[model samples]
Target: MTRTVTLCEVGPRDGLQMARGRMATGTKLRWIGQLAAAGLKEIEVGSFVSPRAIPQMADTGEVVRGALAIKGLTVCALACNLKGAIAAHEAGAHVLAIPISVSDTHSHANVNKGTDAQVEMVRSIVDWVRAQPRPMRIDAATATAFGCSMEGDVPLDRVVQVAAALAATGVDRIALADTVGYAHPALVRDTVRAVQDAIGDRLHKLHLHDTLGLGLANALAGLEQGIREFDSCLAGLGGCPFAPGASGNIVTEDLAFMLESMGHRTGIDLPALLAARALLRESLPDEPMRSGVAAAGIPRTFHPAALAA
Candidate 1:
């Protein structure tokens, strides 16, 4: 069977969080609306981290509420701890992703917790989420599952162990992330297979970054491994504000165009996705934007707009 894929737009959260300038809430909502109109079914709207840590997400509650109004969109948000998880729940996030770095050093530096502590946090968050009156999905993303910037070449056993530990938390789903873009294609395939072996059907999404320009390559490898869900940003909008020279997450428009042209259905209209990139450019003029399809322009043979016109 040819597996279908789901593109979960992370531009609103991951893209904007690490950006230089903050995007207005209305503009964020507008961009989100454009993404929905482009046929995206799921979007990571914002993070519940401290406003002091990531001021760009100060208005996460507002964004979540606005996103909730959009029918059929599974609005997700990142939460690092139990506190952030509760905030996500209160903000009405349909799905809450808790990131736990695999490397002990990275985990400590990023979440101020050791590996075990982070696992405990996930446990608490899972329990808290299940107690909510309204149903909400929890996805635990093993950040730096392949490699880490602070700690290079994280061992495969470590990543597998973390996934195993997170599974004990009873999360609705689990995802592996190359948070620093340190992952190569082979490593992506191998690690994804490892995690999937440990968690089976619970392994649902892959979050990749373009730091080394292999975002698409890694994504393809994961797809070949039967990963149906992917996380991407519009116009490649974000990078680690603290980690200079790192590019943003994988470009959603480019990824969608690639998949659809290859006879894979993403349910997204390529032309509409490109138009949404224009809105992002207009909003953040100074921010550097990047995308294969947006820059190269669609070929004449792939006239998506002509059919719609």
Candidate 2:
């Protein structure tokens, strides 16, 4: 078997949610298609939050429906509660990720509820999904797992506790997210190990941000900790509005280069990914997009065996 890495493209939701302008349903579908064409096996198409709360994601259902047409790809959507989960499941998303903010302050700001309340809601959400005729996959992501911008450094134990809580909810996966980008390499390694110890193999994913410029370093730490699935945004566009000083997510193009250079197969075509990023930049002209590989260009000397195939 070829050693592989899964890169979950989150630009369609996390990246676009905070942008200056909203993308039409047709445009969002076009972007999802481009990402799927570039060989990304999974894409976070959009979120199922209330339109009044997040107007940008109002068309998430349509985006998921359209993205389902792409062959050999998984469509995912973000949902914070039972209501949103139903929408995502009804929209036919293959996976629905619920962000369980570890910080009470961030949690209150994000969903108008604290961490305890958030945990209490998980079982209800899971039960409701199970009752559905075709329940979608669930991923309980521990957002702000690292240091919360609102509440200094979060204890490793707290992060692990939340992961355990999510695991008890019968979620399919649990991902640790550096929502504010405040983690160092050691923290990532230790936290991942602890989460695994608490929740077993359910700790398979990491969602990182480049806010403090440690995105790649943390990702390297995660890989060393046996993590394979990563969440990144195209052109590094996104931020947590509630988390002060938060920046865009880890850059997908740059991350793909890093992973491929290290002999891991990601199945993403560098040229095709750049083309997709260009289209995104064109669509959101005013939205700031960042990609080290995009700005500096890929080194001609670097070629991975996976890309050659």
Candidate 3:
């Protein structure tokens, strides 16, 4: 039996957050439904943040509610603080992802809090969730775990420290993010190992960016280190508005293809996944979509692990 790799589609949340124009609530729901149909089990539906801050995510509550109705899909939402996490819980999100930057400068710029403060916020959020009657999984991402655009060369020890802190907070899982895409394959391997040593199985996912075109390479390194979950955007839609020079995330279609071709089970329908990209194209025509597989169609001899099994 082949190992199953979990791919969490973050296009609706991370992808749209950086889009030039806001995607309508109905359109976003439709695109998300299409992605779920394409066999993406987990999807970050939207972020629960102040509309004034990121007007694009104003409809996150509605999006999360709509996504909850999708059967067999794990609906995830991004929350920057305790208030956002409460909103996500009220909207019936199955998972709440909180990002804590490892770089102090980027942390202040992104969340107006230092790295230590964000870690405390995560602990508070976890305590609040435990008190609630309803259960919602929490995931904390150590952003800029690779390197930061504002503060270059975020030390690997700092990344492990942040991960250990988040894990100590009792969050269900932690993800390492290459927020500015400054990571190479070696960095990914070393960082994953160090964080795993501190947090063990708590570090399960990698959120990589393609700024330096090493996104896939970095992911491959993570796979070698026994990391199974990844965060990707359809049509490669995402970038940090706060982090300068940050590019879009690793393409969902390409990542799925790569994983499937490598005999790992992602349960994604490549052809169907590619077809889902149409909604983004029509909805955000001016938002340049990126994908290597989308440009050159699937190979004739291609075989997915799921289908083979």
**Candidate with the greatest TM-score versus the true structure:** 3
lDDT of each: 0.86, 0.90, 0.94
Candidate 3 residue-wise lDDT, 174-248, digit = tens: 999999889999999999999999999999999999999999999999999999999999999899999989999
Model 2: per-residue Cα lDDT over 188-225, one tens digit each:
98999889889889998999999989999999999988
> Model 2 lDDT vs. the true structure?
0.90
Better of 1 and 3 by TM-score: 3
The 10-residue segment of model 3 with minimum total lDDT is 300-309
The alpha-carbon deviation from the true structure for residue 266 of candidate 2, after best TM-score superposition, in angstroms, is: 0.4
- For every candidate structure, what is the RMSD over all alpha carbons to the true structure, in angstroms? 2.4, 1.3, 0.7
Task: Give the distance in Å from residue 37's predicted Cα in candidate 2 to where it truly belongs.
Answer: 0.5
Off by over 4 Å in 2: 307-309
Q: What pairs collide in candidate 2?
A: none
Candidate 3: pairs in clash: none
Per-residue accuracy of model 1 over 1-309 as CA lDDT, tens digit each: 233679999999889887777889999999899999999999999999889989999999999999999999999998888888888899888899888888888888777789889998899888877887888899999988878777789999888999999999999899998888888899999999888888898999899999988999999999889888999998887766434456689999888876766656788888788899877777777888998788888877663322332
Once superposed on the true structure, which residue ranges of model 3 sit more than 4 Å away at CA?
Answer: none
Residue 156 displacement (Å), model 1: 0.4
Give the RMSD in angstroms, all C-alphas superposed, for model 2: 1.3
**Poorest lDDT segment (10 consecutive residues) of candidate 2:** 300-309
Model 3 residue 16 CA deviation (Å) reads: 0.5
